[model samples]
Target: MNILITGASRGLGLALADESLKRGHSVIAAVRSPEHGGKLAELRERYGANVETAMFDVTDETAIARFAAGYAARGKRLEAIINNAAILTERGSSIEELDMTEVARTFDVNVLGPMRVVKHLLPLMDGTGGVIVNISSEAGSLHGAYGGDYAYGTSKTALNMFTEQLKHAVKPRGIAVYAVHPGWMKTDMGGSEAPGDPRTSASGILDLIERRTAPSRRFSFVDYSGSAMDI
Candidate 1:
């Protein structure tokens, strides 16, 4: 399968790319800065033709459109798209102390970014079928929301809505869209104190992707382990 992963420069995105490659799947590692792709560059070198790096900033619609056009021009079709690019700019901030500007930026990346990618890339998906995974968080769950990190939580909640809407629109087209919570991994954003590892979370997410069969048209926000989550 040919997969496109955004924010593949580090953290869970990079881990997902690594796990996919290990499973013999081709990966289009989409990074905002190809030059600063860090581990992604190493994967390209090690995996050779199995890994391809593409410059993609989820927040930039023009760039996403251009990338989709390039892929289409080459007659490429994607089996899956993992919308893993996001920002937690308002971590630990109370509502009274939240920065509106940062909150807006977070939404631009965490919410609109995935929406743009899905809208543009749907045309390039393989005719056989495809899956769209929006990386969400438990913090976004209204049933589980415990305050703080307003921007990140709100953006993820909005993303969940987008995922549901996209699922409905694309179900007849043989495309399955889902919002997946990848768990709190020990990455730059997740912090060193976080208990989960990226590789484990990535592997579990890949398993969920592999086993997904959303036949009922009843989309739900789920965890990497395939357990349902509150939206």
Candidate 2:
């Protein structure tokens, strides 16, 4: 599979990149900064031609368009895109006290970022039967509980809606879209006190994708265990 993972430098995205490489897939490791993307250079050395790195900013539509053109020129098409780039505002004083700047920053990455990614990449993925997995959260579940993390939850909710819209628009062309809850992962963003390790979450999510044959109308909301969630 020719996989493109945004925010591949760390956390669950990095873990997913590692696991996919181990499975002998051609991977395009996408990161905001080449200098900051970790372990990817080493993996490129180990995996030889199987792994390649791409410097991309998710918030920039121009960069994504250029990336799509460049990759197509290389005679490759993206089989999957893991939309994992995001930010959180968990430690703010309170929902009312949260800084508005922080809210804008969160939406830039968590909401609009994925939409921009799809805008450029979806056309290339048209005939290739691609998949788009948005890294979503349980906190976005309005049926579950409203959380203290207002900004993060709101952005994820928007992401979920976008995923739904994309699935509807693309399913006829054999494209699949899903919203994944990586499950309170113990990454820098998930915090040290988080429950699951990054590796576990990545493995489970990969398994779920491999096992699913059809896209769901409800947008395929699932945890790391393949358990469905109300959207």
Candidate 1: global Cα-lDDT? 0.87
Off by over 4 Å in 2: 212-217
- Looking at model 1, the pairs that clash are none
Query: Per-residue lDDT for 118-210 in model 1, tens only?
Result: 889988885847788999999889999876778998899898999888888887988877898889999999999999999998998787667
Q: Which residue segments of model 1 deviate by more than 4 Å?
A: 212-217
Question: TM-score of each candidate?
Answer: 0.95, 0.93
Q: How many clashing residue pairs, candidate 1?
A: 0
> Model 2, poorest ten-residue lDDT window?
208-217
Query: Which lDDT tens digits does candidate 2 get at residues 1-231?
Result: 788888888888889888888877777888887686766877777888888887889988889889998988877787888898888875444866889898898899899999998898877776888778898999888888564778898888888888888889997988778898888878888788987899988887676555553433465777766678887
The TM-score leader among the candidates is: 1
Over all chains combined, what TM-score does candidate 2 have? Answer: 0.93
lDDT of 2: 0.82
